[model samples]
Target: MKKVLITGGAGFIGSNLALKLIEKGYEVTILDNMSKQIHGEDYTKSNLYRNIEGKVKFILGSVENKEDWRKALKNIEIVVHLAAETGTGQSMYEINKYIDVNIKGTSELLDILTNEIHSIKKIVVASSRAIYGEGEYICPNHGLVYPEEREDKYMSCGDFSVKCPICDVTVKLKATTEETKKHPSSVYGFTKQAQEEMCMIVGKSLNLPVVAFRYQNVYGPGQSLKNPYTGILSIFSTRIKNNNNINIFEDGQESRDFIYIDDVVEATILGIEKNEANYQTFNVGTGVAITVQEVAEILKEKYNSNVKIEISGNYRLGDIRHNYADLTKIKKLLGFQPKINFNTGISRFVKWVETQNIENDNYEKSIEEMRQKGLYK
Candidate 1:
C-alpha cells in the first residue's frame, strides 16, 4: 500500500480526498494547522477535522514550518501539498501572510526534496484558476486574447466588462485552457502561480514527478461557512439560512467555473496514479461557466429563502470578471471528466449545508476589511 501525506488534509478537499484514498487501500497521514478562519474556534470539534481524526495519522502543524514538513513526510510515498492561505480580497492587505504560506511554504518543501533523502514518489500541488486572472477571451478582430485586469475607473462607473488588451474592444469570454496566459489579478493568485512555477522547476532538476492542478472555484460539502473572505456559495448559503439579504457584487454578472468536491478529488487522484500527469499542470474544472447572480438565485430557490438578492454594483480591486477551464488537456491525457453538473452539484451541496449547523454570517466584516484597505468599493 502506498502511504500518502496530505498537507492541510483536514480542510474540505483534503479531508474528502483522504477518506477516498483510505477506502482505496492507501495509508494516509495528515498535516494541518486547522486555521480558525476555515475551521472556526472549535476546530477539533468541527466535522471536517473530526471526520478523519482517528482514521488517519493526524499531525497538528503548519506548512510554513520546515519541521512540520519533515515530520509529515516521514514514510510517505506521495505528497499532496494543499496547505495555503486563500482569499482574493484579504490577500491584497495580508500580503505577508499569503507569501509566507503559499510561496515560502512551497520553497521549503522543494528545498527539503532537493537536500533531504526520502521515500517520496510524487507531489501534487493545488493551484488556482485565479492565476489566469482575466483568462482567455475572443476579440472579434484580434482572435484569442488575454485581457489585463479590469480597470477600476470603468468598473466604478458600472461598466464591468473585460476589454481586449490589443484592440481595447469588448471580448467574448472563452474557456481558459491550460495553455492560456497567466496574468493573475490578485496577490493570492500571484502566489499560486509562483508555487506552481517553483514546483515545476525544482521537480525537473530533481527528477521528481510534480503535478499542479489549477482547481477552479471548488465547493461542495464541508466548505467553511464562517470564512467570509472566500467561498461565495457558503457565504450565500449562510446568509439565506439566517434570512439575511444576499449581496451580489459587480452587478452579479462575474462568473466562475465551480467544480464539485467529488470531481476535484477524482481528478486529483487520476493525476496521482497516472504517469501521463508527471511534470505537468492541468486545469481541473467542469468547463462550464456559471454567473454569480445565477448562483444566488439557485441557492435561494433550493433553500426556499425570502432573502432579497441585491445587485449592488460593488466591485473588488483584485477580482476577475470571469474565468472557466478549457479542460481539453486533462480530458485528452488523463481520461477525466466531471460527473456532476452545476445543478446536481448544487442540490447535493445545499442538502449537505442544511444538515450542518448554520454559522454566523461574517461576510460584511470581511467586506469591511477590504473596504478599509481601499480594495473594495
Candidate 2:
C-alpha cells in the first residue's frame, strides 16, 4: 500500500478524503493544527476528527512548520496539501496570516522536497476558482472576455453582473475554463495563484508529480458550521439554525459553482492515481452555476425555518460578480465527473446540519473585521 500524508487532513474536505483513501487500501496519515476558527478553541471539543478517529495516523501540526512537515513526510509517497486560511473576506485584513500559512507553508514544503531525502514524489494542493476573479463572460458585441471584479460604482446601484469592457453591456457569465487568464481580485486569491504557480514551477523543475485542483465552492457534510468565514452554505445554515435572518450579499444573484465534498474527493483521488495529472492544474466543479438566492431558498424550504432571508444589497469589496468552472480538462484527462447536483447535495447537507449541534453565530464579527479594513462595503 502506498503511504499518503494529507496536510490539513482534519478539516472537512481533508477528513473526508482521508477516510476514502484509507478504504482504498492506502496507508493514511493526517497533519492538522486544528485552528481555533475551524476546529474551535478546545481541541477536545471539535468533532472534526471524530469520524476518522482510530482509522488513520493523526498528527496535530501546522503546514507552516518545517519540523512538522519533516515529521509528517516520513516514508510518505504522496502528499496532499489542503491546509490553508480559506476566508476571502477575513483574508483582506489578515494579509500576513494568509501569506504565512498559504504561501509560506507551500514554499516550506518545496524546500523539504528539494533539500531532504524523502520518498515523496507527488503533491496535490488545493487551489481556488477565486483566482479567476470574475471569470469569463460573453458580450453580444465583444464575444468572450474575462472581466475585472465588479466595482463599487455598479454594486452600489445593485447592478450585479459583469459588463463588457468595450461596450459596458451586461455579459453572460460563462463556464470559466482552466485556460482562463488568472486575475484574482482578493489577497486570498493572490496567495492561491502564487501557491499553484510555485508548485507547478518547482514540480516541473524537480521532475516531481504535482497536481493542483482549482476547486469551486465546496459544500456538504462535515463542514465547519462554527466558522463564519467558511462556505456560504455553512454560514447560512448556522444563521438559520439560530433563527437569525440571513443577509444575502449583493443582490443574491451573484453566483458560484458549488460542488459536493464527495465529488471533490473523487476527482482528487483520480488525480493522485493517474499519471496524466503530472504537474497539471485542473478545475474541479459541478460545472453547474447556482445563484446565492437559490441556495438560501432551498435551505429555507428544507429547514422550514421562518428566519427571514434579506437581500441586504450589501456587497464585499473583494468579491466577484459570478464564477463557475469548466470541468472539461478534468473530465478529458482524469475521466472524472461530478456525481451530485446542488439540489441533491444540499439536501444531504441540510440533513447533516440538522443532526449537529448549532454552532455560535459569529457572522457579524467576521463582517466587522472586514468592515474595519474597508473590505466589506
Per-model lDDT: 0.93, 0.91
Backbone clash total, candidate 2: 0
lDDT of 2 by residue, 1-377 (tens): 99999999999999999999988999999999989998888866778878888898999988889999999999999999999999988888889999999999999999989888999879998999989988888899989987887778988888877888788898987899999989999999999999999999988888998999999999999899989986999999999999999999988888889999999999999989999998889999988888999999999999999999999988888888888889889999999999998889999999999899988999999998888878777
Question: Per-residue lDDT of 1-377 in model 1, one digit per residue for the tens?
Answer: 99999999999999999999999999999999999998989888889998998999999998889999999999999999999999998999999999999999989899999999988989999999999999989999999898999998898899999999987899999999888999999999999999999999998998899999999999998898888888989999999988899989988988999999999999999999999999999999998889999999999999988899999999899999998999899999999999999999999999999999989988888889889989999
With a 3 Å backbone cut-off (N, CA, C), the pairs that clash in candidate 1 are none
Worst 10 contiguous positions by lDDT, candidate 1: 221-230
**Candidate 1 — what's its lDDT?**
0.93
Tell me how many clashing residue pairs each candidate has. 0, 0
Worst 10 residues of 2 by lDDT: 43-52
Off by over 4 Å in 1: none
Give the Å shift of residue 373 in candidate 1. 0.8
Kindly report which residue pairs in candidate 2 clash with one another. none
